[model samples]
Target: MKINSFLLILLFILMSSVTSSSQAKEKAKHVIFIGLDGWGAYSVPKADMPVVKQMMADGCYTLKKRTALPSSSAINWASMFMGAGPELHGYTQWGSRTPELPSRVVNEHGIFPTIFQLLRDARPEAEIGCLYEWDGIKYLVDTLALNHHALSPDYTEKPEVLCRMAESYIKEKKPTLLAVCFDNPDHVGHGAGHDTPAYYAKLKELDTYIGRIVSAVEEAGMLKQTIFIITSDHGGINKGHGGITMQEMETPFIIFGKNIKSGGEFSESMMQYDVASTIASIFGLKQPQVWIGRPMKQVFK
Candidate 1:
């Protein structure tokens, strides 16, 4: 009888340990970051962006009420990646001029270590991939040395190429951290203006692209282990950003995935830098001391 009791206790202890380890592994979540360039809150109510709307309905969302300096792509993208403002990352505009250096874009130096670099340092086994417009990822990861792949240079053909590349990466690479950027809305908004038919068409195309990404993840059986975040770098007004207007500054923060609470919007004003900090926190990474923003803790349930 004593031997039987001892064996039962040992079994219980082993089961408990296994359960605890499974929970820990679940906590080690994967993240998919989608950056919609020139996407504004205005577009949300107007466009038939079903995927994004569904994400908002099923996940925690916050009104990202903030503005980017110079309202340029490079500056804001760097801020979002580094979790630091222009002052810290040292890229304040799309075209920046340093004394003694000719007027050049942010991609010229490409020396700063991005969030991916930090992730690599903390968890060397973690797989990371980036598909973006312009030099956002390159500047962040210092692609000059890392040999990181980008979609293409021409804006006209980039989105389609990006979709194909992302599909291939997700299927083959199974990255722990993946970031995809869509620039259609931003391009059309600049050329045709917001709320126009052209802008709406661009948004619809972008939504279709988003659906494809989600479908690929689901097919790979990674949906349950993935945390998806959809947001914009900054909004625009009259073909420009940087202005403090609500349409230009106030973006959306939509998050959905396993182990996340759903069905609510956060009213608190959050900055762009908070995105980087939140991502870092999600992976148990140390937030940069220089980052002034805090993680959106409300999303995790």
Candidate 2:
């Protein structure tokens, strides 16, 4: 009886070790796409964005990514969502003219497939969510596809509220993909130039939200396999975008997560369209043949 008990104990130890190791190898189960509407690419290294820097410590980063032509918020966000530019996605109008929220978008026109539509069609059971601050979101995606869609006030004064809702939902739902759109930086950037002190301060505040969301992911035990793609639709030029100037068009892409090349900078060219394409490719979702955007191969480990 003593010998039998010893053998059983050894078997249990072996099984426990094997299970722990298996969990360690498990990849991230979801993708967290943190899209900062007007997040300036230049700040990735220049500004004191601790959260962005911490992510860079384990991800492939680039400071020179580009947004689509017309460099406006509405048009580029469409490109970021559908992996196509304005000419292809058909979003000509965007952003606020005065300080009010923009009108709802109509997708009744013949629009190309978006990440949301493809995900719903391909993985119907998989849950997805988005917390945004802008009304242009109506034009950026197919509303029916999102299982949890939350928005802040239309005045762009509620990023903290948006983040809190997203963080709580992520902890509870653990969706396959969650895009948290923080607009306060863009709001601050437009009023005060991109290089101004206030702009950096807003970025620091944004970093806190990023940290909270990451912590929430960690608590959910999905941090290891969760892929984080941090990017922006456009930067700022003086107080506005929608121009050909590099400041308005230039943006950044910091992709940090499981299966991604960690602790390195990618020299490969990247852009807003690539952002959508990468999300599709990361999850083995084959891009449609007609899609022009291609995933950045260098992002993979």
Candidate 3:
């Protein structure tokens, strides 16, 4: 009987350890999610994005992260934010301002529940904002949930201006969550063709923008308390996405700062919806029952 008791105690201790390791030691005070529209994992090898490369080295990353079917902007963006694919969230088209199909569920805000909505509902005082070059992002993120939301004048002509605005917002508000979405890469991809010189040049430019945002966070004395996530809506082919090609479906997902594993590469399969779930986990917020995303908890140390 004593032997059985001892064995049971050992099993309990093992289970406790597993549970502890699965959870973050401390919840993040700030999470910066940077979305690069149409940046493909295939271009990572050839692009001169030193800032992004450094992020990959410093954090847990996966080049194999996948977008939802019909790899396009609005559909995958909804998946990333809503924590479910088109069938569930119902934002099925390339640039859908509203759901092409009926959403399975919605929150008090009267739209699909997004990470922003989740945070707002749970922590009413938490500062949440988003700055994007794409106007369509407003519809996806549920602007009513955000404390602040802005659309850049023109991404292709003045990308730096958007970055500066993001920097200023970070330094001033010290937001609990901030999403900076760049539409330049996708515009360039469609205009000059994906995997071309212009596409790479555009990516390089956006990398500088990311660097500026990181600096702004550090300048605000929130560096140690902040987590950074970089990902994309979809990739592209010759001139467009919305297809099943590897280039269109595969995008890089990088998570760095504050309790993340250093130089770790996530080998597990991850979906676009998982990004929202991961953010929810970092904030220690309970995910809505409608969300199908599973957090990439292995990224935490």
- TM-scores of the candidates are 0.84, 0.84, 0.91
| Worst ten in a row by lDDT for model 3 | 19-28
lDDT digits (tens) for residues 1-301 of candidate 3: 9999999999999999988865554467899999999999999989899998898999999999999998999999999999999999999988899998999998777799999999998889999999999999999999999999999896666768789999999999999999999886899888999999999988888898899999999999999999999999999899999999999999999999998889667899999999999999998888999999999999987
lDDT of 3: 0.92
lDDT, candidate 2, 1-301, per-residue tens: 9999999999999999999866544335699988887887766566788888878877888888898877878777777877876656666656522212222332343346778777777788988888888766765776677787877774354447877887798889988988888775688878887878888888888888888999999888889879988888888867877788887778878888888877577888887888788888776677765567888877776
Per-residue accuracy of model 1 over 198-285 as CA lDDT, tens digit each: 8888888888888899888887779988888888877888777767788887788888887678866877677887888778777867
Q: Which pairs, if any, clash in model 1?
A: none
Clashes of each: 0, 3, 0
Q: Kindly report which residue stretches of model 1 are placed more than 4 angstroms away from their true locations once superposed.
A: 1-28, 95-113, 144-148, 153-158
Better of 1 and 3 by lDDT: 3
Which residue pairs does candidate 3 place in steric collision?
A: none
Global lDDT of model 2: 0.77
Candidates' C-alpha lDDT: 0.73, 0.77, 0.92
- Which portions of model 3 show Cα errors greater than 4 Å? 1-26
